[model samples]
Target chain A: MRKQKRGKRTAQEKANARKNITKAIWRHRELYLFMLPAIIVLLIFSYGPMYGLVMAFQDVKIGVPILQNKFVGLRHFNRFFSSMWFGVTVRNTVLISLLMHIVCWPVPLFLALLLHNCVNTKLKKTAQNFSYLPHLLSVVIVVNIVRLLCDGQSGLINILLREFGKDSISFFGDPKWVYPMFVLSGIWQNAGYDAIIYLGALSAVSEELEDAARIDGAGKLKCIWHIQIPCILPTIVILLILNMGQMFVIGADKMLLLQTDLNIARSEIIDTYVYKTGIGGSQYGFASAVGIFQNIINLGLVVLTNRIAKRLTDVSLF
Target chain B: MKRISGERAVNMVIDVLLVLVAIVSIYPIWYVLIASVSSPMEIAAGRVLFWPKGLNLAAYRKLFEMPQIWMGYKNSILYTSGAVLLDLAVMVPCGFAMAQRTLPGRKFLNTMFVITMYFSGGMIPKFLIVNAMGMLNSPLAFIIPGCVNVYNLILLRNYFESSIPESLLDAARVDGASFTRFFAMIALPLATPIIAIIALFSITTHWNAYLGAQLYLYDPKLFTLQQVINNILSRTSSMLREDISIEELTRITLETNLQKYAVVIVACIPLVIAYPFVQRYFVKGVMVGAVKG
Candidate 1:
């Protein structure tokens, strides 16, 4: 009688487990249907195309299937490494990126702090809207505006200088001014939009700490320095890490727009160089090789930064 | 009392400085608007400053006469609207689905989506895939590859999870409503602000997209505004100098510059008009997403 009862209990437990599995599947069926479209789209557009990266290692020819392309292991890579222009492109890319990062990253933080400190809501919103207007202007428009302002003969900038008894300067043509112009225009176009992130961070800071500081006889500046800055430090650090990770991926469109025969030496970063070679020279393999090189470097930077961030602050992009 | 008054004075000075900065920031836009309306001759001579000497719409008239400009406008509208709709169709459902924590394989799907935010199959490969799909010169090519933005999807997903209460979803489920009905009736209404934000972003991105159009479309008729403008600007010195007479050259230069500004104004105006309606939603959507993430 005891053995028969035990056997019946075991069968009941198996039945219950099967019911649970079925219920779980049924509960999640809607989610699976919803995710289907995005999954298929990403698989095709993103993951499926990853196979084409192998062409970077091949001698890719036009009109040939990527699979049929000659397998030339690391030949394009060697060519890229040996090219005379590689040093110039790498140096230009890193220097401009570093300069822009240094100058452009912190200005937004300062702007956010200033905006946060403003007592009047109307004034704050008006300032924000005005600042964000430039961000709405397309790169094409921004570049055209830059050209008009910096035109040699009839440019407003030269006209202003000439009125002050100064000679016309070829702002776009000069290599010395190229980096500065790129950095400055970048700051102009992006600072306001970037400040929104910091402003978000600033708003999250607790007000009780500021009040307590005031009660302790801390001045406004001291209170802000001690209370607010520390509160937002993690955000600043995370942004810094992310910024560093993208330090090699310079803006090719802006560089291409700004490139002239005269400024080619300074403005020809890796992106522009790859663009010139890929489209102009029709050296697809070589261009792909350079692109792959850039990706590897960027990947390394991101990993390194993530590790460092995690080690120091226990926060990481992952 | 004296120190307090001194602080107030300093604050007033800072306010004036900020106002000055704002003017400087907006000056280029003002300069272009004024210049576009000014007579090309006066603009070329550098005599017009701050405002148009004579308000004329000749450049605009000339631009309207160009068949290419109208074609560009049409292409841009088709591309932006189609892409935005596709983005929404794919992104919204996926975001809602991902928001369901009880979903099987949720962790795996989330990882897959997030992986894309960090890496991509570089541009050439993407171009090749689009070409292989026979999407070249087709409008589908422009919209399909960009159907989903992972970052936007994540934001939308997070918004759904936080804003749409679990109790509401559970109640809908208990009412014997299908998943589609539940999302359609309950969740989507709550997600309007985020939807608007993503829609605005999609429209702007697609409208300004020149690279994809340049790579895919060979037909001049299919060119978007940015692509046409780029061609005109890049080839202007050579094309005009070769074919046109010296007398007409000056006229062409002046005309082209004015037209360029006018094109800038025209291309951006629609998005600018749409912005105010979505601005309130954008601020809240961003704050929620950024703070939570």
Candidate 2:
């Protein structure tokens, strides 16, 4: 059997394999040297932490080696599964993320198409500058800006509201207004920046196609619906799939910053919950269990969404 | 008379709407700018609108008076520049090496880099690792743990392969140049565009990061501009929530509305100034990174 397998391999193939293995080493030695420090950094920081994930099953603490702790199977998992905060957190995260993703996804695409057809290039460039400006600011700055503008007493919006004989809205402090503020900030900070990818795709679209549609007696809106939408549909679908992959991955940092005690009911998310329990409370195993649970769900959603997109639109991340 | 086509009419309407949005988009920054110099009493009473009620330098003066803000700026500048250098040092070579088809197991290394982007050990494990290594509370904690972003690495890798011609590399090899010599002398010079783009990204990320400072740094001296801004914002909002009487407003709170706005602007000044310059490169970098990878 071994002789038969060996006989199947041509002499040229054997020699090429040897060359690939042996000659590549000396020739690419410097390349390997270049990659060495980075590889070592990744091994220590990225890969090492992944290995350290095993502490989810162990009752471990910082300053001690993770392996020293006794592994109690499913204990942390059981605590998380039955915890009171679990359902609240998952529901809040899904509700907020789903609403933001669906609502905010198409604004950029719409804006890009509109901007592309705009007659005044100067105005278009000026608008582009304004739109993407917020993307550069950190979440804290954005939230603070929102706070200043939407402040119930001195805020510009409330001042305008009071002028019209309407009650001032408590945007940051009230539980009801939290979601609106979150979604609005999402649109403001991201919509203009997010539109660039679609803009890139849209700018590449052939003018001939649009002209042909117009020649066919189609109006502006009709041409957009028929020609423009379908042309960028693949990019749209691919982006949608990518967005779905991150469905469970809520913004822990932003949420933590935006959370007020008054709006805590609506604000708490899975990532924040984990951060509190794991780092804040020092319940390492419990936090890791929650983190693992979340990551697994995110992975499943991404794979499932990718498969669906592949079937429906013939576009997928993979 | 030239006739206006229905298409032209529709385009006009879209233009009007886009202009309105552009105004809304830019107004937040502009509003804060005018509000920061307005009298505190006017701001607190919701009287300041469209422009400053009275031109005053009190808020900006008060903000500068706080020594902590200066310290925050100093620390942030050091951390941002340091982190940028480290990021470029590690990520560029790694990206170049990973892109080289001549390297053994390039595919495997690429996959290894990409996987980290999707799946990580989450915050706790990473924190534990950082803490165990005694990097907690240290500037190295911020610089070392996140020196290389996998997405940026992948983007750089893609750029290297797509932009750098293979024949140029071959010519260098034909001249009997070692890989390091060729990379340093020729490749590095040609790779300036990507290096600039990555450096900008590194500067933005390191400068803006606050959660790290919140979690890791116990010493007040090590706090970044973002952390100090966060504290200022939180304290101001809580004070606003209390809603003191007009007579008490002057004495009840130390943070004037002008000071609050002034401080926000101060925290954002460095980044805001740099943003427009790099905006074009930023868009290109993001588009390539997003669409391809």
Candidate 3:
């Protein structure tokens, strides 16, 4: 590396920085006034709750504020660890995250790539628009559809199963299939819509570059593998890092709707566990502890992934 | 541009696969709408496939009769519009100010914004804060906590930074335009695309959201459409266990399926109407971010 430039600024440069302070203040006061509402809202909703994360370290109750409570360092975390839910919650969170990365993450990319490769523009646009429709459906609505089509009585899939001379699978009732149900539905809902990013990346890759590859005698698969995927790897990495950051955040409402006594074995993940313990169980501190633990891991994963992506690809969230 | 003329066999295979994928992708939605309007007896027999056998608005009529469903609709519209209004008022100027390099306290405030994106206090803490603020059981709980989406803020900030040229600001200043005048006159006009994008997101998000309503509001009447739909779905089975004979109950059960589809269909009508516009702007917004990213 070259020599550092610390303390090396010229007198003119230093003066340039200080020249317009009063002027900038007067010129930008209206802008500052404009932003104050947003700043205050963030301070309240975002930062205030962040300060309330201290409940994780306190013996706190509802109605009573967190600071009013006694400090109980690691008591909740210790209890969480000792409890049986630690294993179940952690296992479910990780399993879902892995399934998302391994199964769902690639789907949009594949769809995007396939669409990008297609010559028919109308078909491509139609498929693209059609794909985002499911995402627009509310989770409740989607889960309702899942219940309908996955029902043992008159589910379309089970009807088809009987026609094919096979057993109709109980998707919601079975513990093993519930996770797949979550992941596959996720893929189904998001793949087409999320593929927009990859399509954007594909569009950004120059037609000239592909032509060059083709002129050099590369086949269709070869062009995609060597050129297209390579061009979009930064985008893929960025998206992957984002997906990884939310590893523990399997959504709560969907799980609650989907959970049966039969499949609670798989659906009782960290979020649901926290919700039940906090609101239903009225163990605020313990719930907060569980929440704080998962979030800390999430924060660490996000930061770690950001750093790795930054180092390897010269792209990062920040 | 030289279009690659791959093998005829390859092209045919790709076309066939694409058609299949599109069908599979849209088939469920098709099924839902068809089943809702289809002959109920035929649906129960699993004979209603690909299209409605006896098309009718009976389920829709039943849905309209339920005053609770209408209340859910009223609540949904109130929340969606209210939240979007608050969101725009907060985010536009906030994002614009953040985009200004010379804005005082920019670095500190930007740090505040970015940190919140990564490390939010968990839901319990958020609930406590909201409870402390007495935003609970009020429309404010839904509207206020989620008013300024940080991700949308980032997108808007990036848009302001890039699309609204520094030269334009300088020209406005030369014309004796104050910062507020410049924003209202110059920036706002150019920022329509960003506004549309964020608006689309806000509408869809607030419309589809159930978890927030679940956490914040307790009153059944205050429940949004998703929560209303959820209650309907969960109750369908229990509703089937009336003391009537098994045959009569089975018929009711099948009718209840139509009810579920009708509720969902009713809830989704706004989305179905708005999605064409949303699809265009949303894709455009993401593409804008992709280029920047």
Output the number of the lDDT-best candidate: 3
Model 3, A146: alpha-carbon shift in Å?
A: 0.9
Q: B128 in model 3: Cα distance from truth in Å?
A: 1.3
Residue-level lDDT of model 3, residues B94-155, one tens digit each, is: 89989987787788888888888888778888887888888888888999988988889989
- Local distance difference test scores for all models: 0.79, 0.82, 0.83
Model 2 per-residue lDDT at B126? 85
Taking the tens digit of each residue's C-alpha lDDT, what string does model 1 give over A1-318?
244555557777778767976898787787788888889999999887676578788888877888899999999888888888888899999899889787678888877877787666777777777776777666776777787778766567887787778999998778888888788888787777778888888888999988887677665567668988899998898788878878787857888888898988898998888777876686877787888788778888888988998899887877
Q: Which of candidates 2 and 3 reaches a greater lDDT?
A: 3
Q: What lDDT does model 2 reach?
A: 0.82
After best superposition, candidate 2 residue A106: deviation in angstroms?
Answer: 0.5
Query: After aligning candidate 1 to the native by TM-score, how far in Å is the CA of A132 from where it should be?
Result: 0.5
Ranking by lDDT: 3, 2, 1
Which residue pairs in model 2 clash with each other? none
lDDT of 3 by residue, A107-209 (tens): 8888887788877778877777788778888888888888888887777788778767899888877899788788887787888889988998888897899
Query: After superposing candidate 3, which stretches have Cα over 4 Å from the reference?
Result: A1-23, B1-6, B239-242
